[model samples]
Target: IVSDSSVLLCVCISLCLAWLHGDPRKVLHPTDSYGRFCGQKGTPNAKKPILFYFNILKCANPAVLINLQCPTTQMCVLKCPDRFATYTDMQLQHKLSKSYWEYYRQFCKPGFNDPNKGDFHIFRPNLLMCVCVCVCVCVCVCVCVCVCVCVSYRGLLISLVVSLVFILLLRFTARLLLWFTIIAVIFLLAYGMWYCSMELSQLRETPGSDVAIVDVGLHTDLQVYLQLRQTWIIFLVSLGLTEVSILVMLIFLRRRVQVAIALLREASRAMSYIMSTLFYPVVTFFLLAVCISYWAVTAVFLASSNEAVYKHTFLVNTFFSLCQTFNRTNISKTASCLGSQCTFAFYGGETPYHRYLFILQLFNLLVFLWLVNFSLALEQCTLAGAFASYYWAKRKPQDIPPCPLFSSFSRAIRYHTGSLAFGALILSVVQLVRIILEYLDQKLRGSNNMVSRFILCCLKCCFWCLERFIRYMNRNAYIMVAIYGKNFCTSAQEAFFLLMRNVVRVAVLDRVTDFLLFLGKVLIAGGVGIVAFFFFTRKIPVIQEEVPTLNNYWVPLLTVVAGSYLIAHGFFSVYAMCVDTLFLCFCDDLERNDGGSEKPFLMSPELHRILGKSSHSRISPLQILLVWDKCLPSSNSKMLQVRIKEPKTTEEMCHPSNMSVKILSHSGHSISRGNKSNTTTPQVYLLTSHPGSVLRFSKKDLQSTAHLIFQTHVHTKTA
Candidate 1:
């Protein structure tokens, strides 16, 4: 027995030594031919324990192995390396390959791997530590909440009511503004029409006489006549179109228009909500930089690829042309150049200049599409995060979720690349088609062939309508993707279905919202233009005298208007996106909850409460009582009980009139009373709660149902 014990002790000691040393295969240092450590030259630590060697090696250092060891008396420890630190080729090649670097650069640290210099590391130090901290905070919060609830529930209730009231007041103010703007727009349009009619009538009397008098040595009477004729034609056509639009709106599409306007209003509200957060401006600026960069890159590519062809094409000259037009430069000189030098500019091109220009335009179209799509996705995702956070905060006011803006934005850029690209590609193709049609129309404008022009016009109109519809659908689809994390197609289909299901609501809300937004845009742009005019003319009077050549106030007015439009678009686009997102969310909530007792509303309590109050007056008392009762717990039997007086007449008994049902017990049982006898008037009671439990009865039987019973009521009365 002693001999066997000695052998077992020896084995146990060996195992302990092995464990302390750890497995040889797990060691990080390279071994020599004799399977010994490749020690530093002339170092006395060559024979140091392998456990100590690994303990100093950094975590995530490719030079280090998977597992490390320490002496049995000490704990094994590893220090994480700086993520932004440079690694040796050997280290990176072995552990962090090229593919891994690509992923790391994209998701882990963008712009970090630039050869010139590494960016600052922005990653969280330790996920585990963060999680632990968050958990502790939540626990503390819960404890604090419990104490508050126990101590001052009444105070909390009062505060909540005050907040809700403030919100209601703000909502009311917004609605009043919306209605005021709509009425203002209508009046403005009417006044403008009256002014236009007066001007046109005056113009008809004068015609080319005024133009001839204004024409200097530059133009003859013939040129004046042609210009006046063209102006008249354009004005008449515009007036006719406006009249047609008004007729169509008033006669056939009034409801649809209203719906569109409502949708716009909703969008505006959503925009206000989203912009209220700081994340919006940050995301907007970032996206704007990205878009500008993309545009520059695309322009460079197009210019570099087909320099000669692109130089003469609209692709290169479009912005310049707009600038020239805005500056009111001599169009006659431009026209002369177009007829002479510009016609032969592409003659010496290597490729068919038109084809090359077409290809370059196509490439640009794709780039623009990608930029727009990416920006849209970014905005949608950010808004989604904002909406989600808002919703979560509303649902659990004490435990608000963290701002998910960056996280959601990153997720969208990473996961939804394909969806974004696909959506953008579709829209880009449609836009390209529109561009082509416009180019064709411009080319054919000088042609007198009415049939071709008419055909082009019809095609353009159809495509314009189609484009608007697709754009709207695509936008809503993006909202769905943000909320539900679905692919583009699935999200689009779901959005379409949701819209269809709530068509009436969507129509009414959409039109009203759109009109409100339109009114806001007009007000903003017009107000800015008017203010700018006064500022430039009256405030800066020296500017008019100093720059006499710039005599036209029209140019500055138009510039201000254009600038205001851009500003409004930027500001309102965010609101529009918010509206779409929230509307979709509201629609989703309706589908999921159906305003039933079985499911609570997913909307914010304030919104739900406000909407309920607004619409409550329209609902019948029975519906309100029934729905309220259904939502209540069965423990409130005193409130649920209702008594109806038995009828004394034989005719009433035969008809079984004025029967009232009272929910009596927790087992889905109800007590229904009716008079079954002519003289004694014995009460007939039913126990089942189901609607089907009642026997077939005429309308008269239901009409006779009576008063509800309550604890305060001493006698039954007719309902």
Candidate 2:
């Protein structure tokens, strides 16, 4: 039997060595070392033949194993364990005992799992979410009571008021509430930052372990920390700035906000829309938290033998703590359900410190709830948005093709991008494979060389199949579906071929228009700054501003320059945000025509030549304008367009230096500018530091739309 098994192993190894070069043939050799046989034959006339190493392996206990690692080589042994030898040998090798293999089989993950795993990954805590939204309740309550109130937006006041009228309520002193929330948030964030900084930045700091990936969650439990490190760091930083800026802006614009609010009694529309969009981000993570919320109350639930799972769970509680702190609530119920779905347990046994992990979630929650209000203003702009939406929507609507110069701009962009979708398929697949491998590698322990190798091999094979499959799906969808049973990559692959994403982003963003807005903002801000400096200089008229004496001329100059940059950036950001809102209004519904002219993807260069396609695809300016208009309930009657023609001369077409853009907004209250004559000439373009956003002609021409320009900040809105 041993001799037969040896012979069989030799035959498999030799076949694998001959066949394995890559993974296109993995299916052909599912269990054996098929990878060993992948390669290509060189010229038939070549003198030397290529050689490959074939590792050998054998198992002594056939009755207790289905497969075994070869002693000499890590080749899989086709062994059948004894207890299930009858059943196991009928499947694979007749080497190992079935009992041993069966025992190990229990460790393998179930073939099928929750399909919702990949869909809409929301995090947790229903009660906590409800608590976070209490500010909304206050608004509604104020409205119902006919009080001069801030809580009339978001329907929160209505919900809370009704609840209070019928049920007992708990309240806190305003001073105590503010102080507690602030202290707790800063504390949690500091701890999280410390833990992640300590573990992730230093590779040596990671503990020696069999399991992997912890430097980064609660709901996904493990994977969240692995994937969302960059996003969270950005969010935390942005959150601080946003809260601070909003509060400052509110203080400065309080009377303005109040006046605006007074003008519009029905200021709920903007509040609803803004809140909905803002809430979406939290919903994803919070749902994950709720699933684990049940584990919050009980300490025994988290006991795990697997140190990786244990540590990861600790991180999850930490994350949940942050979230809960932001809102101020306990999320034990959420933890329980997530705990069930996560099924986090050690592979061998349970943890001794299980109880400690459970309480960690509670402590984290307490901290999060306590710190939320001070560091973050959860509802600062609710009233402003409410007024903005209500006032804008109730205003008169007009119709005009207000911007003729921007006509066909989007179609040009679309034509350029849609043509290249096919060529980018390979690159996209490669990128996707890289993402997958990175994910797998991060999830496993860095020290487990064997597991890492196994994972890498599997991923390599997976990626090979995926690449071919993407190609196959793009070319012959039916053939791929007929053979692989389904076609999947065409839509995704098509999006990559052209500069579709870039073109759409730029056009929908009205990036060039935004640049013009930023230029104007900088000009005004710089002028103001110069005036202030001059005023300071005159106060000490003999101070000689340029003389680098006690007054250190460079200090003021540097400060002014830095201050100018900051002001310019701030203004630019505001303008960019408005422009984004405008662009989004245009492309909101034209999903296929979003980036460009709704052209089908072009596969061949011949098609491109015949069609006379542009280098990138773009949707029509009008199309985008319409979508943006729809999204922004405030600017229903207005639209702006900037169009650059494809210049006949190579200098004009190829170099942005010669490119001219025409900016047109409503001459009146409508956008129906289909038959307008030329009142003013096109604007001259100038380059700016922002590579894509070039400046346009003087600010005097766009003074009327100054408010629009001020609100056009992309950076601020995104932040």
Candidate 3:
């Protein structure tokens, strides 16, 4: 039951302590044998950055592994030796000229100028070969990352086009396209199972291909396992099971899927009005990126704050003294021997702050989760407010306010920050508990007790479900906060009961919509992945010249595939939020407004048609046809009936500014007449408040009022 303010205070304190005690330089720079940071400003070894090892071959000694430190001297040097020169050769050349000694002395210990003590030392190439190998590997990886990042933009662009097209198709042909997507996925899985079966059959005919996967164990090369028949059999079984499950679900839930598709189409229509909502995910992404960057830096600095531990001269003397006192025979011959020492072994300290550093790291993770969830909550509330405006509007776009997205964003930031933060804090606590449980599970992975493992597994599953339930509840609570401007607890209670009231719809239609959206994302990612695979593998002759060559083509191919999925997910998240918001609004509309004349449903005509709820329930068919009885000339004398409740007063009828109407033709085409000069068909004059009072407008006046309702000839009915 941690409050938002308490969470904020804890985060501030953790960040403050981390910054005050942590030294990022300790993580960045290597340390010398003396434990001083290399290249640190104003330090003794400020000019020398790279750590050099003396007799680097001795690092292979078994004692190095036991002690977790190299068993040789290490020095901070400005640069590696440019050429190979053994100490013996340097010593031989030192008698003739001091130049070789001058150049080679940089690699030796600080005041050890006597060359004869460096007996049997070869100074094997300054250890640059090993350093170069590591540097080359790092450079290659960085280059690959850069190339992948640059190439990923193409996938992102394609995903943008594909997602936009998908949304548009959903708006126009939701049922058809959704059914197509589902069937395509099922067929694709079936094809995969068939392919795996074929591969398994072929492998059965080959010699030595029947080896069990267990016999090969775990090999670094995956091709070894792929060559075995067991791998194909596993793939075949997995695909077969998946295809069967999907087919069964589709068969049983076909009706519910139609309802979900209707909801998706409505969401798409809402998005069509507020296209700006599609780009709001970019703002969420930027905020999340900032939170992630800050958390990563704080974690790194806090982890590097421990004091550097090294093997010092005092420790070496203490060890020798202990040995002399206990062993009692090593002092006489070993008195004049120069004992070896190690450089930095590890990072740790006996200080109380260092001892409690793990607690600080945990605090950091909690704050990160809180901030990330808060960002997500803000996005949800803002989008909910925007779509709620769309749903509640009496008329479609004309009654809808201008810049609804911006207005909703402003409202969310101005008033609901605390509510969002509170919701985020609740979710963050559950997520933190789940993370801790996962960590414990990983730590106890090797334990032999079946009871402990089972208990841990059950705890993990319970917490995982709890986390998911909290997330779902928090999402709906944010929507309620957007609509009602209530506190987190009240909104959450109301949202929970509202959902419980319609649990069947929530379980069936809502989940079906989610599954469809997930399928769309997978299709987009897989389609783009297939295209990228062909291009990268040079399977496409046209793009072979454009593709960049790499040692492993799959690296960039996988990067493109993953990036496309994320981009598609970002786009699809907006649609998901819209659907959820509209569903909640629909439920609220049904519960509160019963489509009576006084409490008409605010949902659109299509929703009413799909859900079979008419807003003109209280006002029966004849009551809506209130007609004026005056007859006009022979050329145009059409009786006009306005589908509105009978007015009690004359002013209410004459000046009906609050009335909303849809004008339509006999053929069901919406019409708004503009000019009298182009009156080839027919025209209806404006009626005054009195039953027989008529007011005729000039052609110019009709043209001016034409912009108000820009359709063709039609009857009038209040929507």
Candidate 4:
């Protein structure tokens, strides 16, 4: 037996070696009994068939390999059968087009050409049957276990159902409240417009003769009064049309609006989740501080270098002007004056100060652009990292630290600085182009020529589209960099590809999320406006006395609205980013995990539960794996030893060290050596080491082993 085993091992080794070093031609084209190649018929004074030669030899003699006809040399000779008149030189030329070494290097190795010789390839068609079997078994087991668990926990199930019902009720109530608010706002605005029109008409109808004469004397133009009345009428008509349009939109696009609202809620929830972390606010403030400092320094540098004359000569005035530009305020009057002075200073003064100022301004602009891009990139990176960390913790079911924001932020600055800078540079260039185009468009609007205006309009539209595309790409790239630690270009390319691959899903998600955010902004701004209006009107007694003096209530209301919008945008932007980061992470998780026991999903349990419910019929493999994992003994238990027993029938074959003995009772089949006991020894199996072998133990067997171990320990203690 030993000799036979040795012979078998030797044969296996020999076969492996032969496969690794064997010639392809010898294996593919064997010689027949007549000592001729299988495909060849006769031998003649011609060249040997090129197909029969090895790759190495064929590469050395390229000319011979290229020519199909037999050579004049005695060693290179061949002849074909009479029926093989369909031979063509084109076949040989095609085969020898590339050197044999190159072809062999690509399609074949030195050894046997067996594609399945490497690691287990899940994509192989042959594995489909096995995968199907495993899937079906897993599904069956999961269903049975789930049913049993549900039956055992009837009270919990009831509570879950009640909670779901309550949630649905709340959602419906919220939607109704939103609709009511919209209607109320519309009606109030309409009433205010009607009142304004009535007052304007009354004023216009009152003649100058009927007016009360003042001590200083007063003059009135009837034409101006009439124009004012006309304006009121037009405003009333526009307001009415707007109300009608809004009503039509509410009726026609109710479903879309609801979806947008739902998406916004989800985005808000995602944002809140991140903000709940302790360090998020700290990180946000740190970034803000950096931006503020950078902005101040940049402004100072530009202001100090200005040699142009200003109405106010102090450098502080120039600094304030720069600040105004940074805030996106319309400082066209101040800017125009500065531009004219600068040109005059450049040509008339022509001093070193003027030249230095020009250089400084250019340098400041570039630095400002860079800093803006960097700040945006930094925020995105930090937020993305925080979201990714949260996702990782949830997916792995691990206890994360109270605040990992600093760690993530530091990593982003250290590892992703280059990527961030690149992204920022691209974004800055796009923004600069957009600004230039907008300026040109504004200038063209003043021109009388229609063609120039039309051209500028087209350019503006194209640039707007381009700017949006670049921004989307840059945002996604930053997220990718945060998650994967890739370079800017690679991350951007990958992000583009990922979006392209899932374009429809991305489009739907983006539209839904954007609408939801837009609605939130409107709600915030409008709510502030309404509150301010009521306070100004003395409807709120608590704050009526504290109201500031304003020329009109509308002025204060509009200011509050704008302020509220800006605040809302700042707060909600973080949430919107969180939503985007989580979404990309989710997409990556779907692609990487196959729902196998070995490859667990990296997503939250809540997300998994939601997915399971939605895809119950076509349950993901990961879900099935999760179910199986739950059924298994907890990996956290260190007291239990897991063993895979080998197949064996003889009791002696099992090692003594590997087995434990225990006493048993005959009547109850319990372990007790002292009284009413009978020895009922359980059979044991040996263990083997084989890659392809799987050892499965019955639940009954495992239970018996546990019982035996317990009894043995007890018997020893008593003795």
Candidate 5:
């Protein structure tokens, strides 16, 4: 039942190799150019956790383009340099004061005592000013604790409550909630436009604020852009366009939105019955975390496999590999001028194993992507199966199976693993190509060849769209696979056609539902963000004392906001899947059954009513006679009076061309025709309402099945 046992085996083998060869320390700790991991315990550089570049400007050397590393001397340091002082300046000051030498020694390599030994003495001012900020252990632990407290109380707790309430609201008041969310989003955007306009108007009156952002160029402090009038204008225009777009969509697709809301209501009902599905995202999150951890560890090990190799660069453009151990005496030989030193170049080797590390890392990436996608596919399939049970059941909760989520999950893991892996593999391949294209784009960013850049950009965009389409197709295919237990390719084909057959509904209903759900997420995130901002900023008077004092409160505020959005998304994702499954099932129901008792619709009665459909298979004889009397002439109606008589057996009465009547038995079987009777007695009974019969008769005469009616004419009463 494992869909692709071979693929699973390959995954296992790849992970095993990765675990055997990978060392995660390379990623967790910074590494010096000397190939030693900084901050690692039980090492010489254990006390020196920070890696420092001797000449930061030399990092801009053209060799960086080829080697992907700065071509400069790097060393481990205990702390960053707080003050800027050139080696030459420090050397002269050292003679006047011992403090200068003590301070300068921290920047020098280990065991270097005499500064006069080197031939090069000149040092650039930029060489020593580059500093890397390092947080102390205590501070880091404190921040971690604070972040945990904030996320647990402000983020997780609120998000969980909000998400549950939102889902429940959707079940009973889906239309109202969806419309409210849509309106709120529009108003929020409108408010943003107004605010931006106000800011722009005020900035126009302020001198020096009229400068264009382009003239100012880029700034490290983003607040500088706010001072420019053009920035606010751009924001106002962007918000205005967004507002208009949403309004236009709402106006044009109002009916479709209503349908989508109805579908959401159905989905909510499904989720209400299968409450276990709301927690399935936790399982998916755990699986994804495992995959990401494995990939990171393997990549680190593969990268660290290369030992430190040093390259000695002379100030005059000559380069040599420092293959042998050398000391200050060797430094003098290389230092014909300033900037000459033995620098750690790149991590690599001539061995066959080291040569293939790139391939191994790529392999690691591919497996990671495959596993991530597989986990998502498995979730989709499991949720689909659970909701599918809800859709197919005739009775609401009584007919639905118990523990549907568990059964569906078991089925997905036991039988559809291979199929899930197959689908994930196809997507993984496309994603890997997109990643490669992105990498190439980044590499070509500095190139003068515009054609190559354009080509890479096109490839990137094409692959992006391709990934989106594939993801959509894969989701629907997994749903089909869950319902029918078909192979990946077969299910994909079937789902594709099913969607194509109802392309209009697919476009209008499904997308509108998604849009509404997205708005819900944005609303939750934005509302929570506002509350967090107030709490973090101590703007809420009641909670001011409870708020922790932090150097930057935005950190925790952003954490809460992002956490809320993710939580909301996870909960709403279940809702979205439910809607999609029900929609697909609804379409299938419409196609396979004609709303007749023989093949009644499996959809809920509410859905049937909303769609103006019924399952009745036939019209009753009494109702038929009433219609006949009304439509026919009065003389014929008086002579041909219909009366009821108890019958011993089911029978059909027909007067060849004049009239035809059939009686259906309790077992849904049609009886043979009886001889044309001259007696005026008539047996009129409802076929569908009879005990032991599941059939229901419609009042309409348009049924494709047998009907009860009388052909009326004046000649019938002449006798």
Candidate 6:
């Protein structure tokens, strides 16, 4: 088709050129392969078919050889090879003749003269929008954080409100109720005096008499009794009653003072064991959290039956809610996380079985979060580990040495015991106030009828509290020695001795503070007793008698209460002194047993109290490792919402709601790499000594509910 058109164009051009004298050039049609103007007699109308044949031939398969002849009016065109014949590899066999595939190769090259190798950039608006989006998210996060911080810092109201909310949510609280009591007492006293004055004025004047008349009497016993009016007798009786009341108050105050002294004296002893208690208000909240946790845990362990489980759980929760606020004080999760701890971070002991405890711990945390969403939490993540990590990260290797924490049990005992004492002192004050309030309310309402019942109740309460303290102390003592050592450590004993010596040196306050406290007691006692006497004389005309009644029951009863108070006060003071002496004796005796160098004492009231009681070393906080175990005790039917180490494998459609557990072998042993006893060590070398194994393993935290726990394994020899 191209040849025919070219022949026609050539003939026309030749004839026209002969007519017009023109020149011809084939260079302009370099892209065209068809023979240019070969036949001079070509018609212009036949050019279309020649061009179409040239296009078809250009795309023809190279594998086939085509032989063709064309007329004088036709044009010959060579075919271009198929585009699929491009060279993937430079190997010679697969290569095609370069010329035959030129059009195809050129077409595949993308553009006729693209200098940019596929790296060519078509127009793109720069994605500043993406950067803008990233910037916006960052800005949003930062703004939210800033707002939170600003609100937290700016609002004292927030602090106050949160504190109040937390305090109210607590199950046990020590509230300051003195302001209300003092106000009530002041108003009552004012009202009583005003009423008394009115009554007395009316009594003095005869009801129908125009003027007040004085009854004339000669200087007889009658005149003496009426005007001076056995009132001197009333005065003497009141004084006696006042003395008795002072004595009783002195006793109560004395005990409180003694407990406070004991706590101050033993400050070095009880740091670790105290169950940091919330005030009464939020005790319920804490309890609620525990109950919720337990309920969820129980549901998982006992999967199937809903009736028995829900019924029992409800009853338990109700009982827990109704329980006295004080009962919620001592529960702690610190012991459980490290229970059955392995020898090293990545190692287990005895059995070939491998347990990735840390992962298991994650499960525990999951359960905890699921069960108890909100509570006063001490997360293990926040404790010593984070600070240690941070400090180490910042610190130089040369600067590092030992980070000594709590090293022994004797020391722990002393520190924790002191803490307990301090806590007890505060608790005692709370108890005293509570009793006083209860007493006042009861007497005013006449609920118990007996006026003396208030004192009896107070005494009973005191006894119960003391007993509880002793029991707790004893339990901790046994546990400490078993877990760590006989004492927190040996230096602990020396510290106690030093503490005692200082206490003795500062004996100056032995009588001073006591005297002041005694004064407060005396004032309260005397005021109450005299006021009562006045009440009986002026107001209660029920037991009226012509002569001074020999049978004034109020006098004898008041006397008994007062006398008991005084005697009890004095004797208890002596008993307190004796207890202090006992503590001092123990310290002295222990010192002699140790044969350690003694230091001279520095006098201070704190030192004196400490000396009087006993001296013990302080516990290094490091020794007291706090672990997070968010699991319910097995004694409870409900489990805490924590992942169990043992996953339930079988479908427990049959597992009853109340999980029945049986005890299996629960045994433990301690393995120390070094010498077992470092007992007779001196102070300087003491820190270097290889103290044998101190293992605290427990089966309580294991997946098996039936296994026994080894709380006593390291501490004692079983019978």
Q: Estimate each model's TM-score.
A: 0.49, 0.19, 0.71, 0.48, 0.77, 0.19
The residue-by-residue lDDT of candidate 4 on 1-719, one tens digit each, is 01223323433443343334323333244322112344444543123442222122223332322111122211111322111111132234335664422322222212223333334311122211222234357797676545533332332333333323322332345455445546665776677588767866686765552333332243333333334455466668887887787677678767656654544343344444445432343455566576566544443433333232223222223453443231111223554333212111111124564445434434444445655667777788888887777666632324444555667688886788777776766666677767667767666667899988888788778878887888888899999988888888888898888888667557766765665555555655655566656766778888766655433344345455665665556555666787688677766776676333344455653343322222212222112100011233444532223343432221212223322333333233554322222344332221222212112223344456533222222122233
Q: Candidate 4 versus the native: TM-score?
A: 0.48
Question: What digit string (tens of lDDT, one per residue) describes model 1 on residues 636-703?
Answer: 34554333333222122122223334433222343334322122111223322333222222223335
Residue-by-residue lDDT tens digits, candidate 3, 1-719: 33457756876887788888777765567666555777778887889877777666667754332223455666777877776766677788888998888888887765456776657545544443333344557898898788887876787789889988988888789889888888878877777788888888888888999888888898845668878999998999888887887788889998778878888999999999999998999999999998999797788778767776744232224344333221211222344333433335555677898888777888898899999998999899999999999999877878899999999999988888889888888789888888888878777789998899999899889988988999999999999999999888999999999999878778887788899998898888878887887887889987789887666666677788898898889989999999999989988987887544456668764564445322223211111123332542233533344332333322232433323233343344443432122332223333323223222323333343322221212345557
Query: Model 6, stretches more than 4 Å misplaced?
Result: 1-500, 503-509, 512-535, 538-562, 570-574, 589-688, 692-719
Determine which window of 10 residues in candidate 1 has minimal summed lDDT: 69-78
Off by over 4 Å in 5: 1-8, 22-31, 36-50, 55-71, 77-80, 91-121, 125-132, 135-152, 202-208, 211-231, 310-344, 537-542, 609-719
Residue-by-residue lDDT tens digits, candidate 5, 54-171: 7766766543432335666667788887777666777788788898777767777654667655547654445553325434555786777677555446666787899889898887
lDDT of 6 by residue, 381-496 (tens): 11111112212221322332233112222233333333323323333344444544554555456555564566656666776676455333332232222222333233234434
The best candidate in terms of TM-score:
5
lDDT of 3 at 589: 85
**TM-score-based ranking:** 5, 3, 1, 4, 2, 6
Residues 415-505 of candidate 2: C-alpha lDDT, one tens digit per residue: 3122222223343545455555765666564656896679687877888777665543332221111112222244334323322434644
Q: After superposition, how far is residue 144 of candidate 3 from its true place, in Å?
A: 1.7
Candidate 2 residues lying further than 4 Å off, grouped into runs, are 1-286, 294-584, 588-719
Q: Considering TM-score, which of the candidate structures 5 and 6 is the better prediction for this target?
A: 5
| lDDT, residue 484, candidate 1 | 71
